[model samples]
Target: MSSNLGKIDVEVEVKSPVDKFWNGIRDSINLFPKASPNEYKSIEVVEGDGKSVGSVLLIKYTEGFPLVTFSKEKIESIDEANKTLVYSVIDGETLKYYKSFKGTLTVIPKGNGSLVKWCCEFERANDEIPEPQIIKEFAVKNFKNLDAYLIGA
Candidate 1:
């Protein structure tokens, strides 16, 4: 199966400081399960020294889906100087539909708050499923959840 690759970018204005938003970005694995328990069951560090650049996160999903998907993301890069984070989905059910998936997050100072850009690049296994758009929507929703959780909004 062969199909063209796709990229999705979602940018949102967050009513939070860049430092605080960056902290939330770094703690996403632990915070996501707590904020969105319906979608995420748990996340555990399986490799490396935690959330650092080489670390791997094993994410378990909540029950009741026809296809239960587990996400294993490897932290590719973390640049605190630029407030940027990059991770790759090395394993999971998403790989069943995508040949590759890469997630990048950046926080830029905007006025008193911050502007967050969440981008995902994925190559589909075939043209059957629109995994790129699905992941994009998922990212946006999760970002909203994270923003709300961070600001207690």
Candidate 2:
């Protein structure tokens, strides 16, 4: 296998209107724990102005086999017109595994529903950490939860 470390991207199709999908993503801090109680324990705004740009959120995870630790991500931007959200890891256990981490979520209108795209760009601190794979899995699960929430599934 070729050893190339880079950004990871995952996309999910939601059976809901673009606006509805965007709203769910915009309020992800409050929605995630409710949608996927088994994966996420809780989420709180630790600093800044909530979901707006510059805000920071602390995400707590439920204990499980993988043993995911909590993380703190700072909101870099939220574009309503384009339906995009950007954030970066500021202070969290994630930094211990990665040199730098940033995530972007974009919602695109498709027919009656929407397509949600999640992207994570990071540099691993060492070969031990599974940067892209772990990030990809996390994003996929979150995207599925958001899709289910929007469709009342």
Candidate 3:
């Protein structure tokens, strides 16, 4: 009905502190596979100042048409101060129609617990918006995955 796509934003509260959760996410090699499996199939460090910004991280994510599965995403930017990891799509099936996707994971402190806000923005070429509920479903599942991982750690 609407060609303009809406944004998908989801937030989850973790028992862990902000600093701890922030550190966990900033470490892509350690946290990528666990926190987000669908997008980040795997992350491999290629070249850079090792651990610092400009480090090349080959990311394997969902790709393939008809039945999308996995592809590659290069680490475009990493900011530890704001606890943000921005990745640009290099090669992926999902990128074909989705065009582009920017994901951000942030932690906001609230008393003892912290609010883990995760969001993904996508650009669609067609007017096809596969069921609005799917967005909520994805958000819940993704956030739940992060919550479990944080609590267990």
Candidate 4:
């Protein structure tokens, strides 16, 4: 993404309040599919328990006609102190395009509510990187979906 600019950031807030969002993050393994809906139609454990470090998840996204399979995530580090979860694409079809994918999600509470700060940096295995719009769309969509889910909860 030589032509791409600096880091992109997206913020989402739900009406259910901060506690509900934090709860969803805490029980992410169990609530992911439910919270994100069709983005993760199903998830299977690839290794380790779904809790703590070394846990791996394989998610199946619901693509209408063509099957667009991607990875779940390989947990690299989990810090409850910082309230952040770090993950990389260890196993996923998406890795073919992105040589390395690293992301950090932090859950923080604001004055009257809370939200999640999702950030990521990636490298292209090949010479091409995905268009910035696609990346931003994906990131924003995920936040919107999760925010809606939290409001429902």
Q: Note the residue pairs that clash in candidate 4.
A: none
CA lDDT of each candidate?
A: 0.83, 0.81, 0.63, 0.69
For lDDT, the strongest prediction is 1
Per-residue error at 19 for model 1, in Å? 0.7
TM-score, prediction 3: 0.69
User: Candidate 3 on 1-153: residue-level lDDT in tens?
Assistant: 345554577778777778876776667566867787655567677666436655665656554212345545555666777776665555556566666666666777867867878776676656774523454565566556666787787
Model 4 Cα lDDT, one tens digit per residue, 4-66: 323456566545466666667767667777866766677777888866688888867777413
Per-model TM-score versus the true fold = 0.90, 0.90, 0.69, 0.81
By descending lDDT, how would the candidates be arranged? 1, 2, 4, 3
Candidate 2 root-mean-square deviation in Å: 2.6
Ranked by TM-score, top first: 2, 1, 4, 3
Which residue pairs show backbone clashes in model 1? Answer: none
- Relative to the true structure, candidate 1 has a C-alpha RMSD (angstroms) of 2.3
- RMSD for each model, in Å, please? 2.3, 2.6, 4.2, 2.9
Poorly placed runs, candidate 3 (over 4 Å): 1-6, 34-41, 46-56, 59-66, 129-136
Report the lDDT tens digits of candidate 2 across residue range 1-153: 224246888888878889988888888787888788888888898897677898899988888615457888899988999999999998767777777889898999998988888888887777777755766777778778877876884
